[model samples]
Structures are given as C-alpha cells and as structure tokens.
Target: MNRLSVSRLFHLNNRKLFQALIARYSVDTGSKDYIDGLVKDDNVVVFMKGTADQPRCGFSNAVVQILNFHGVNKFSFHNVLEDESLRQGIKDYSNWPTIPQVFIGGEFIGGCDVMLEMHKNGELIEELNKVGIRSVLLDRIEEEEKK
Candidate 1:
C-alpha cells in the first residue's frame, strides 16, 4: 500500500477509537442527580483537577489558595481526573465547560476567576455568611479591633 493509503487507514482507526472512548465515557443519566447531592450536602464544594491538599493544575490550586486565604478550612472537593465520566458529567451538570468548578451553599459560584473576583470585592465573605460559615479572615480582623 502507498503511504497515503496507510495514513488514511491510520486516521480512520484513530477516529473510531476516539468515538468508542467518547461513548464509553459519556455522562450517565444519573450523574446530574449524583452531583446535585454532592453540592447540596456540602456548604462548599470544589470539583477540581486534584484533591484539596494537592491540586494538580494552576487553576485548581488558585482556588484552593483563595479559599485558604479566606480561612475556609472545611470544604468538600472532588478530583475530576480520577473519573472520566465525572470529568465530563460535571461540565454537563453545570453547563460550564471548565474544571475547578466551585459551589457555595449549593449554588454554582463559578471557576477560579469568579472566586478571585468575589474575594477581591469582599463578596465572598458575605456569601459565606449567608451559608452560616464565618470567614476566619474577617473574624481575625474583628478580634483585632476588639483588642
């Protein structure tokens, strides 16, 4: 066979393999429900590239850092890299095509950019207060004033 023919055959096989993986990893119908439970059960949840202790990507790490800076110590997190189905499923669930998705009080807060903006504008503390969690960052400031 000629080089062109062999190249065409290889491309065809690669396309077929890609389709098969897509079919296998497509979001399950119940994935939305699963994600719903996860978000609602936790006041703060992050669907990130890695676990909270060890974020795999810069975006995910930025989110972790922002939350830590705000003194948000207790929050749930899921590493989308661990599950192919979940990686895609979360995007579908949120209708937002990105990793490092954040949820506060079961509401979608958006990705790292949004979180940073909110933190910068002082909106993050208000959001946390609405969910009944005090921001340690703010709490410390208040304590200092009382001294």
Candidate 2:
C-alpha cells in the first residue's frame, strides 16, 4: 500500500479505538447518575483533578485555594483522575469539557477562571449565600478588625 493509504488506515484505526474507549467509559448511565447525586447532595462540589487536601494539578490547587480562602471547607470534591468512568462521565454529565468544574446548590458554575473572577469581584460570597452557605472568611476578617 502507498504511504498515503497507510496513514489513512492508521488514522481510521485510531479513531475507532478512541470511540470504543469513550463508549466504555462514557455510556455508563449509572455512573452519570451517581455523579449527579454527588452534585446535588452537596452544597458545594468541586470536580477537580485531585482531593481537596492534595490537589494533583496547579489549576485544581488554585480551585482548592479559592474555596479555602472563602472559608468553604465542607464542600465535596471528586478526583477525576481516580476513575476513568468518572472522568468521562462528569464531562458528559456537566456537558463541560474541563476539570475543576464547580457546582453550587446543584448549579453548574464555571471552571477555575470563573471561580477566580467571582472571587476577585466578591460575587463568590453572594453565590455561596445563595446556596445557604456563609463565607466565614469575611466574617472572621471583620472580627479581627474589631479586635
């Protein structure tokens, strides 16, 4: 076969392999439902790359820091890298293509960039309150100022 034909065949095989893998991980409706439960059951949920205490990536760590800075320590987090089904299932579940996806009160908030922007402009505090979560950071800071 010619070089062009060989390359085309290789690409075709690769595409098929990718599709199969995606089907294996992405078609488990049970996993997707489980993820949905996690999102709705928690007031704050972070679908990041690692655990809350030890994030696996810089972006994930930044998200963890953002939450911690806001005094939201009781939030739920799912490490996408831990389970292949979960990693792909979350993307399908959220219809979002990235990690560090944040959910508040069962609402799909944006990723790290959105979190950073909200935190910067102080809108994050309001968002938290909308979910019945109080930002202790601001209250603590105010208390310190009065001391």
Candidate 3:
C-alpha cells in the first residue's frame, strides 16, 4: 500500500479503537438488580445530582439538608450527574421523573418537595424510625417543650 493509504487506514483503525474504548468504559451499571441491592443495603439512600457535601442543584441540596436536619449523616449517595445511564435508570427504577430521589428502608420516597412536606407533617420522622434512625428533631422538640 502507498504511504497515503497506509496513513488513512491507521487513522481509521485508531478512531474505531477509541470509540470501542469509550463504549466499554462507559457501560451502564444501573441495572435493576444493582439499584435494588444498593437501596436494600443502605437504610438511607439518596440518588441526587451531587454528593452530600456538595449538592449541584437546589433540590439536591434540599434533600441533603433535610436528611442532615434529621441527624442522618451516614447514608449512601449516587451522583446521577456523573452517569447518564444511571440518571435515566434511577428515574425508571423508582418510576419517578426527578432527581434527588430518596429511599428509606429500601422504599422509594419522593423527591425534595415530598421530603419537605413529609418533614412538615412529621412523617419523615416516622419513616426514619422505621429504618432504625431516630430523628434528632424529635429530641430538639422534646427539649423545647420542656423549656
């Protein structure tokens, strides 16, 4: 083959190899069993746009704040922003079309608005209690009542 033909062949082969590598490394890890195991393994699981310490969106931050308010510091979090397939997969898994999905005791709890409402209605405390987590808000309220 001439030099030109050989160079073109090499470029095409490299392009194919690069695409293959991208596809291989970016395989989606958000299957039903994977998500199920993740939620089941942790009493509190948050699928949000960012990490607990640095939430990317307001709703994600709100979810993190709500959990922190209840004294839940230890929980699993998945950053959907980092994974496109997982982002879509989580929505499909919970049948909820929003980020910042909460799971308590392996049950799908709604997004930030639902969390806020539940917090206001005292249902979040109940849900946490079911997962063996005692809301610190309860203690704070009791202390205030004693005052």
- In terms of lDDT, the best-performing candidate is 3
lDDT of 3 by residue, 1-147 (tens): 999999999999999999999986765657787788878979999999989999999999999999999999999999999888889889999999999999999999899999999999999999999989999999999999999
What's the ranking of the predictions by lDDT, best on top?
3, 1, 2
Question: What's the best-to-worst order under TM-score?
Answer: 3, 1, 2
How do the residues 1-147 of candidate 2 rate in per-residue lDDT, one tens digit apiece?
Answer: 999999999999999999999986665533766787889988999988979988999999998899989888888888888877778888888888988899999999889999999999988999999998888878987999999
How many clashing pairs per prediction, in order? 0, 0, 0
Q: Model 1, range 1-147, lDDT digits (tens) per residue?
A: 999999999999999999999986674633887789888988999999989999999999999999999888789998999887789888999999999999999999999999999999999999999999888889788989999
What C-alpha lDDT does candidate 1 achieve relative to the native structure?
Answer: 0.90
Candidate 3 structure, TM-score to reference: 0.81
- lDDT comparison, 1 vs 3, better candidate: 3
Q: In order, what lDDT does every prediction score?
A: 0.90, 0.87, 0.93
- TM-score each candidate: 0.76, 0.73, 0.81
Q: Which candidate number would show the highest TM-score if scored against the true structure?
A: 3
